[model samples]
Target: MHDFDLHAPEGANKKKRIIGRGQGSGRGTTAGKGNKGQQSRSGGKTYLGFEGGQMPLYRRLAHRGFSNYPFKKTVQVVNLVEIEKRYENGETVEPGTLLVKGLVKGANPVKILGDGDLTKKLSFKLVAVSASAKEKIEKVGGTVVSNETVGND
Candidate 1:
């Protein structure tokens, strides 16, 4: 249609709800606050897990066990099976190459795991190779060169 004829669609512009004006206004008196309670009063609110005059469940339960998950390293993983399927013999495997090959993404450090049989003699660089993975690669006449310590997982 024409630019000058343009207008917002139906209900696109809504009137602001006017509340607490008077009894004539539907949302007046209690202003839709319902019956009297701790919530009906001004600035009356309860903190999370608060129990009225009683101990909260959070305080009742024993705070247990330390978890190392938050502190654990988040490494991008590539499997030996994937390497066997994707690369030719003697090609270098690294995070950048893995990204191009669509095996892994992002800037996280790549860790190679021994998940499948590898028949090709490929070389790995700048990536952590797991212990079992290193064994498989060596058995297949491949080599791994890493700046980081070899991972066990």
Candidate 2:
């Protein structure tokens, strides 16, 4: 009972190294894929973005992110006759006085949209105030100041 479970046990089913059939059988001639390049012939494939030619791993990697229009938030518009041709009825149009009067370009969040006309009773301390610009700024008696008591909202 030794030879472990006897019979074909020690090197089970021998004889499958039968390559290209010739060079006296030791994995025959180039059947072990060596010499004469391109992996020794016969359907040898390697060329559609191949890497053995050095520069290919998607051309050796270096191009990423955004192929256009996935992130769109460039909303910066103000009206109500451009805040009564620039504040002065109670002056308080915040976002640091609309970036010291050049009206917008970073304070990052200022929405105010109502599109034209208002006789000035101005006072917004703003950060997002539309509904026809808070109904034309409370129909021209103006007084917005409510961004939930300015908790950086």
Q: What is the lDDT of residue 64 in candidate 2?
A: 81
lDDT, each prediction = 0.89, 0.74
Instruction: Estimate, for each residue in 1-153, the C-alpha lDDT of model 1 and write its tens digit.
Output: 776998889999999999889999888899888989989999999888788979899889899999998898888988899999999988999888999999997898889999999999998899989998999999988888987647576
Clashing pairs in model 2, backbone N/Cα/C closer than 3 A: none
Q: Pick the candidate with the highest TM-score.
A: 1
TM-score of 1: 0.59
Error of 1 at 138 (Å): 1.1
Question: Which segments of candidate 1 are over 4 A away from where they belong?
Answer: 1-50, 55-70, 149-153
Q: What digit string (tens of lDDT, one per residue) describes model 2 on residues 1-153?
A: 666665656777776566879878777777788899777887878978887878887867789876768765665666667777888888888788887888888757777777777788887875677777777788989888746332211
If scored against the real structure, what TM-score would every candidate get? 0.59, 0.29
> Candidate 1: lDDT of 115?
93
